[model samples]
Target chain A: ETSAKVIDGKAVAKQIKDEIKIEVLKMKDAIGVVPGLAVILVGDRKDSATYVRNKKKACEAVGITSYEICLPEDSTEEDVLKHIADYNENPKVHGILIQLPLPRHMDEARILNAVSIDKDVDGFHPLNIGLLAKRDREPFFVSCTPKGCIELLHRYGITIKGKRAVIIGRSNIVGLPVSLLLQREDATITIVHSRTENPEEIVRQADIIVSAAGKANMVRGSWIKPGAVIIDVGINPIDDPESPRGYRLVGDVCYDEACKVASAITPVPGGVGPMTIAMLLSNTLDSAKRALKFE
Target chain B: ETSAKVIDGKAVAKQIKDEIKIEVLKMKDAIGVVPGLAVILVGDRKDSATYVRNKKKACEAVGITSYEICLPEDSTEEDVLKHIADYNENPKVHGILIQLPLPRHMDEARILNAVSIDKDVDGFHPLNIGLLAKRDREPFFVSCTPKGCIELLHRYGITIKGKRAVIIGRSNIVGLPVSLLLQREDATITIVHSRTENPEEIVRQADIIVSAAGKANMVRGSWIKPGAVIIDVGINPIDDPESPRGYRLVGDVCYDEACKVASAITPVPGGVGPMTIAMLLSNTLDSAKRALKFE
Candidate 1:
C-alpha cells in the first residue's frame, strides 16, 4: 500500500508569497502604491515579538510596507485605543493587526473592535465574522489561520465539495470559522470537542478532518479512516528531553501514524504555521486593492 | 417497542409565560417598571399579521406592555427605518421586533441594523450573532426559533454534553444558530445541507437530531438512531383532502415513522412554533431587566 503524501504547507506558502510579489510589482508600477500593514503589539512577550517580527519580514518579502507599535506592559487601554484610532484614519495603513494576549488590565475585545472593519486584516471583528457566516454577504477579511487551512486545501486541489468533513474543536478563531467556510464549499461539517462522546468513532468516518483541538496526539492512526485527508492545526509542546528546549512541538494528530493511513496529511511546525503568515499578507494585499479600487 | 414520548411545546410555553408573569409582578411591585415590546409590521400578509398578533397577546399575558405599528406594503424602506430609529431612542421600549418577511421593496438588513442592539429582541443583527459565536462574550439575544429548540432540550433535561448531534439544515435562522448553541453546551455538532452526500447515513449516527431543512418528511425512521431525540423545526404545508384547509402542516421528519425509532420527539404545529414566542418573551424580559439594572 502507498503511504500518504505529505502536504508541503511551507512550500505552498512560499509559492503564494511569490505570486503576491508579482502582483505587488504590477500595482506599484501602475499606481506607485504598496500595501501597508500596521501591527500593534503590547508588552515584551518573546512569542508575540517573534510573531510580529516574522510578519514584518513576510510583508517586506511581498513588497508591502510594515508598521510596528510596541506598547509598554503597563500601558493603559486608552493608550492602545488611541494608536488603533490613528491607524483606522491613516489611508496608508491598509491592514491593521493587534497582537493578541494583551495584559490582564487591557480589554482585548474592545481594542480589537476599535479597529475599522475595513482595516481589520486579522478578521477578529464580529462584523466580518457575521458576514462570513452568511452566504450572500462578503466579509472584509477571514481569520488568518482558518483562511490558511482552506488555502492549503485549494493549493493542493483537495476536493471539499460534497465530502464529509469533521472539524475537531469549536474555537471562534479556527474551528468555528473554518466549519462555516467548509460548509459554504458544500462539505458536510461536524464539530467534535472535549465534551463530545465517542470522538474517535466519529472522526474515523470523515472523508476530510481538520484537527484544531489544541491537544497533543489526540487523534491517532486508529482514529483515521484510510484515504482521508488530514489538516492538523494544533500546536502543542510535549516533553522531549533530547531537544534543547526540553519540549518539542507536535500536532493534534499523530503525524507518524497518520501518514500511513491518510491520503494526505499536513505536518506540524512546517504545515499550518507558515500558511498563517502567507494568508495575512494575502489579506493585506486584498485590503490594499480594495481601498485603492484597483481590483 | 415503545414509541417516542411527545414533547408538548404549548404546555411548556405556558409554563414559561407563567414564570415570566411572576417575575414581571415582582418587578412592578419593587420598581414600578414593566417590560415593553414594540413590533413593527409592514404589509398585510396574513402570516405576518398573525405572528404580530400572537406576540401582542403573549406580551399581555406575561404583564409586559405591547406596542404595534402597521405599515402598508407600498411603504418605503425609510418609512420603516424611521420607526425603528424612534423605537431605539424610546426609553420605554425595552425590546424592538420588526416582523420578518418584510415587503420585497424594503431593505431587511439595513432596517434590522437600524434598531439599537440593546432593543434588538429578534437578534438578527450580525454583531449579536458574532458575540454569540465567541465563547467569552454573551449576545444580547439569540434568534428566537433556535433559542426555543435549545429551551425544549433543556426543559426536558436531556443532556447535550458529549452527545453526537446532527443538524439537517444550515439556514441562518434555525439550523446554524442552534448548531452553535449545541456546541456551546458541549454536544458534538454536525450540520448537513443540500450538498451533503449520503445525508441519511450521516444522520443515523446522531444521538440528537434537529431537522430544519424545510423539506417535508426528509428524515424517515430509517434515518434515526435508536433512542435519539428529535426536534423538528420545519413547518411545511402539504395537500390533505381530509383537512378543512386543504393543506396541513408537517415537519421535516416523518412523524409516524420517527415515533417508532426515536426515544422522544416534538410534534410539528405545537412544538417549535410555540417555543419561538415563548423565547421571544424570555428575551424581552431579560432586556428589560438589563436596562433597569435589575439583572
Candidate 2:
C-alpha cells in the first residue's frame, strides 16, 4: 500500500499566524495602531474558557490587544447583550467572538445577531452570510471553520473550477457555506448529509472530499479516490483505555486506512483543529486592515 | 429508445400565475390594499422589453399595481440610484425588480444593491442572500429562479427526503439556492456540472435530477434512474428553420429520451419557466406581508 502524504495543516496554520504577527507589528510601529479582539465568554464551560484563554494568548503573541469577558453560566440573556453592545460601540475592538453553546436559557440567535457586522470577525453574523452567498463573491467574513477548510485546499494548489467535489455534513457552519464557496469558485459540488444514502459511493466518486461527519471512521480507505485530497473535520472521542483521558480524539476519516488510498489527508489533532484559531486571527487582522484602509 | 415524459413548463407557469392573481385579489379585499411591484427597465433590448411587459400584465391579472420606470440606454449610475431611492421610500411599493443585462457601461451590482432589502422582491439583496445561507433557517426571499423550481416540486408533492438527487448546473441564480432549499427540506443533493468527467454515471445514480445546464440535450434519458423525477431548468435556443423566429427552445435534457425512463419530469418552456415569474410575485407578496407584519 502506498502511504499518502499527510497535509500539514498545523505547519501551514503556524506560517499564516506568524505572517499575521509580522504585519501586526509593522502596523503598530509604522502607524501606532494594533488590532484588537474582544471575546465574550458567556459561561464557565471548560472548553469555552480554554478557547478564550488561547485566543487571548494568540492576540498577545501577534501584538493585538485582547479583551476577555468571562460570564457566569447563570447570566441572563440581557447580561450577554450588554457586553455585545459595549463591544459594538468600542472603536478599539476590531473583532468580537462569542463562545458558542450559550446556556439554554439565552437565545443564541438574537445575541449573535447583536454583534455589529464590522466587528463580527467570527463571521457568524447574518449580514456576512448574506454577503458570502451573493454573486458567489468573497464575503468580508466567512464562518471560520469553512474558510479554514477551503484555505487548506487553496494553498495546496488544488483547483476548484469545474472539479467534482463532494462534501459530507450539511451544517450551516461547515457544509452549506463551503459548498457555496466552492461553487463560487465554479467547482461542481455535491452536498450529502445525514439523509444521504450510499454516501460511501458518493465519496468514492469525487475528485476531492471534505468530511465533517463527526463519526469516527465513517470514511475509510475504500471510500477515497487514489489521488483525492481529503480534509477530515470530525473530532470524535472514542474509548481507548491506553490514553490518559480514557478516550482519544479521532477524525471522521480512519487516518491509518485513508493514508494508504488518499493522495493527501489531514491528521486528527494537528489538522483542521489548529487552523480554526488561526483563521479567527486572520479575520481580525483583515477587519483591522480593512478599517485602516491598509489593504 | 424509450420516450421521455414531456414536462409542460408553460401550463405549470400559467396555473401558478392564476393562483397569484387569486391570492392578490384576496389580499387586496382583506386590507383595502393591493400588492405593488416597481420595475426599472434600463436600455431597450427587445427580449427585456417583452419580459417587462409580461410581468406588467401578470401583475394586473393578479390585482398587483405595476409601476414602470423606463430609463434611456445611456442612463447614468446616479439615474438608476434615483429610481431605487424612489422605490425604497414608497409606502405603496412592496417589491422592486431592476431587469438584468443592463447596458455595458452600467454597473449591475451597484444598482441591485441599491434597492432596500424589504423592497428587494427579486431577492438579490446581499442581506437576503446571507439570511438564506445562515443555518438555512430564516431566509428572506430565496432567489427567484431557484425558488420557482422548488415550489413546483413541493406543490406537486414530489418527495425529496432521503432521495438520491443530482443537480446539473451551479449558477447562483438557479442551481446553488435550489439545492439549498431542497436540503433544508431534508433532500440529499449532488451538484454535477459539465466539468464532471462522468456526469452520465452520476446522473444514473440519482432518484431525482434537476438539469439547468443551459445546453441542448445534455442529459440523456439513458443516464436517468428508472423512476427519477426530473426538473429541467435549461432554456437553450436552437436554430430551426421551421420556427418563425428562426429558432426553437429546448431544455438541457432530451425530452423524448427522458419521459419514458423517468416517472415524472418538467417540460422546458411551460414547466419551471412560469414558476419563476410566479415565485417573483409570491416573493413580492411575502415582502409586503413581512414588512406590514401581517403574519
- For this target, which candidate reaches the highest DockQ against the unseen true structure? 1
Put down candidate 1 lDDT per residue, A79-144, tens digits, no spaces.
999999999999999999999899999888889889999999989898788778866567899999
Choose the strongest candidate by TM-score.
Answer: 1
State the C-alpha lDDT per candidate.
0.92, 0.84
Each candidate's number of clashing pairs is: 0, 16
Q: At residue A36, what lDDT does model 1 achieve?
A: 98
CA shift at A57, candidate 2, in angstroms? 1.1
TM-score of chain B of each: 0.98, 0.94
Q: lDDT tens string, model 1, B26-128?
A: 9899999999999999999999999899899999999999999999999999999989888888888999999989888877778888989989888878888
lDDT of 2 by residue, A128-220 (tens): 777777664557798888889889988888877867789898777887778877877777777888888888888887778888888998998
Which residue runs does candidate 1 get wrong by more than 4 Å? A241-247
Cα error, residue A198 of model 2, in Å, equals 0.9
Q: Which candidate's lDDT is highest? A: 1
Residue by residue across B39-146, what tens digits does model 2's lDDT show? 999998999999999899878877788999999999998999998999899988999999988888987778888989778877777777777766645766788888
Q: In CAPRI terms, where does candidate 1 land?
A: medium
